[model samples]
Target: MTATAATEHVASWYAATANPAPERPALTGEIDCDVCVVGAGFTGISSALHLAEQGLSVVVLEAARVGFGASGRNGGQIVNGYSRDMDVIEAKYGARTARALGDMAFEGNRIIRRRIEQYGIACDLRDGNLFAACNARQLKGLRDHKALWERYGNRELELLEGEALRREVNSARYLGGLVDHSGGHLHPLNLVLGEAAAVESLGGRIFEQSPVTEVSHGEPVRLRTPQGVVRAARVVMAGNAYLQGVLPALEDRSMPCGTQIITTEPLGEELARELIPNDKAVEDCNYLLDYYRLTADNRLLYGGGVNYGGDDPADIEAVVRPKMLRTFPRLAGVGVDHAWSGTFLMTLNRLPQFGVINGNVYYAQGYSGHGVTCTHLAGRLIAEVMHGQGERFDAFAGIPHLPFPGGRLLRVPLSALGAWYYATRDRLGI
Candidate 1:
């Protein structure tokens, strides 16, 4: 679906339970700054915060409210690393480059923990994340994943199987699981809102309801909105899949895919703990995966199901509730209190697309389904490159991403068919 009304957040459990914050005014007149960031989600806010911390003047503009896109409506699991794991990076871009990228794989998690402590952001910040396996093949992959990650100095891990795995989730769905001490889950919207407050405290500015209609790329980049124009020496296109038409070049390289989530009515503390006894964020190893976790208030926030073409399922609640039940039959009669869908960019290779456009215009997109922590990393990389510390930034930008091959008309159907094939494979446990 299109962005919700600018004045309010979309219908979501996060919106209902969100902490209070002052509403930011929309851009209404011409303004100039050292840098202008489009989209006030994680990337924009994080970029603004990073730049402002350096004492640079930064302005952020958003189509709707802060974290109104995938940033707000995600499953809230901060799974470490990229959509494509490090092994794929090594195969595609050699060991040396993969090693360099690997160093920063978990850096975003550190950035998040630091922000929570430094700013005292109350996001229900927790520790540890679980990667569950659906079958023996995926179980072996998790075993290998533990080894691969340990090689990168990430040694805080626990492998669980048989009764241990079932005890952790209290479900028979998973064959095994890998728990990463560094990864965790939290109130995603609150995290972004707190970061936005921190950004303002650091002297950065943010504008809501100020969607850019045009971007004139020149020496002093001009971003034109209906009510205002922001001119800056540098511009960042961080809108990801939600960005439409402002820059056709970046839009062509990423496809907007929809994912749905449902939050069950408060299950009392005992039931909640029983569902996830350790209370770690859990995601399975299927290609089309289901992720769920207990909220601070003890609700089961479960999310899965993807629409590759960015179309909303006719009944989002209907589409997702069954999936939740299938995973936890004990919750057969649990009433779903909230349901919502949001979009994220998908790339051909399932890797994030990071690069520059016309030299001064920077863009990052297509995180597939792995954007939570990566968006913060994207902000850091953007800040690094803007200051000429391009090594780490280039490590990602150096990787290439092809445009959606089927073009405007056929990409949706083409990608959907491919997704079906892979999802079939996942279902068959092949």
Candidate 2:
């Protein structure tokens, strides 16, 4: 559960191009607040902002600078829906609960748009997303997915086929795609940092470089950092993959899996338009999905491939460059400007984990790979639960999550073995 490796993995394109913000002072001496939040990522920051708006005293603790984790380093695809499909949820839960969850997913996207407008966070917000089909089987799957979504009255998506998709993407690699107008892309780091500023403006205190080393629950929870401590009426653990062993019970529900991304040098307006004609973010239908989008500066930021264990694969470009070339080989000679990696929390059911650890201590994590929009909704729901409205929160809490098989030491290997099976299925076109 050490975070030394996680800290070293923070050099990203987002970090290199981030705008300057005032340095948040580190935690010093002891303090108390109504709520103490761990991890200053999207979930924690968004929660702090909402809680502060409700006139609650809140404090946020971060191990590094603001937006230093996956919140800053993700592919920035603000996709709608949960990690698992709604139909799968309906099969497990009842149809009523599944439809409610679908509505919640749509609400999550609305919350993101509202926050961006309210805060005036200028993060290069774009308007569309394309879920492409790399093979014939995937093409059929995308069509089925479109019909399923339509069944839930979610009809903002269209299924493209034949030459229509090829005309838009100019990629013979994909047979067709599902275009979701509800989904889009943005500069994630800017969004996170801007939300942090909004939280501070609302009188919430955020401490950077203040990692929580221990926590003890009493009438008021006490969170201890290296230099200081925070005593609050309640505590929220939003650290996600970087949670480490701060909360052992929560840590067992998921494992940290590393994903890599690389951005090529600017491709100019003509080539950018040719790559993604309508300037939409694109991800192919694969167990290990390939996602990419064009930056405001015209760089093609492509991401795919995952490292199941803790190994940070060398030659990231060697692994991802060919995938990018496969889609847009026209950029074969384009030089990659920045190559980086980040860790995402993956749950056993591929669903987000939301539940109260004890009674007063609530935690949310394990959004799988569908966190950009879901995290915002999670924050709002957590805020509602704190404000004595726990209906929606309990709905998500009903979903069960089990600890990874094998003990702490063996979990990684077990996960690697499981991932290999899915990887094989994706390759065999199952």
Candidate 3:
């Protein structure tokens, strides 16, 4: 099965404001390396960077530009933990697995910060994330959330409501919220682009517009692209939602979900602060939630809603603008400058799917909606296993991931039905 031809990054607010970067040439000849990574998004770039730092020859093949997928177009919130929280992991997978996973939950955030400082990458880092609750029940859940994370040794939390909560977000949509001081946001595209540069600086090779069309796994895995082929000691399949046909097994267990975002014209420093005081990223607590943050230039970058099957909505702003208006009614007439959508792989259990295929092929995907931080963590774990340390890697790989029921035909409606059920409950405040 051949993969789709590589393309350019979607035109997004991030892309418009992105730092200047050269267009890397496509792979056109055979190459050999210690490792060949498929896809140049966060996962592939992160993995390549880590391995290169270890003195291993690494070549990354990207279907599009680095950060073209979710890495460039996500909510940009550095949310810690998996899509499903630690308590869920503990309940379903037992304490040992949860402990292993929890230990590395916050490590991704650290890796990002370290790389930024060490490499002088300027991604406009911010210093906090707010989890706003729409109702009393959700607020109570935030309290429990705070406690659950604290149990896992993360104490950089503060529960606030009424005036206290208003001070942080100033929006009336939230009854209260929990602030994760350790969690924050940044320019996601720039972060991944910087990481890709870091990988190159470490003598790593990254070929853009080089999508792996075929894989022949063996002693030395062979990956075939349109114009070239890569023979590597190992292969890392890090193309999340965008990777298709090249690996049917990975696609079977995960469903690609499209998410939409719209960026409003700069609200000015004063109005931006009034909307999100203290300049922290904010995501509400709901089955289908809304996440928004102020860009460094004070533009309100807000995103939400999900479309199963990775189909971009016809009108992105139509799907997301109302939610933004509801959150900050004061910006009712604010003009939206850019609207776009991107796809992220969602697993049945909301945990990332990590494992080996044919023993020499390693892949990690299905980050659900929490790819920003988890992808960084995935890179480190993959590097660790390659270095003969598999304990942490096994902890994630050992978790079982079942394929979505009803197969391709019915999976979308089935998942939509489940989302509708929870969304109904959210509306009823149950």
- Candidate 2 C-alpha lDDT tens digits along 343-373: 7898888999999976888888898888899
Looking at model 1, the pairs that clash are none
> Which candidate would rank higher by lDDT, 2 or 3?
3
RMSD of each: 1.5, 1.7, 1.1
Residue 256 of candidate 1: its Cα lDDT?
Answer: 92
lDDT (Cα, 0-100) at 239 in candidate 2 = 90
Task: Write model 1 residue lDDT over 225-297, tens digit each, in one string.
Answer: 8799999999988888778777777667788999999999999999998889989999888777888999999
The candidate that achieves the highest lDDT relative to the unseen native structure:
3
Pick by lDDT: 1 or 2, better one = 1
Off by over 4 Å in 1: 1-7
> Model 2 shows how many backbone clashes?
0
Query: Would you estimate the TM-scores of all the predictions?
Result: 0.97, 0.96, 0.99
Clashing pairs in 2: none
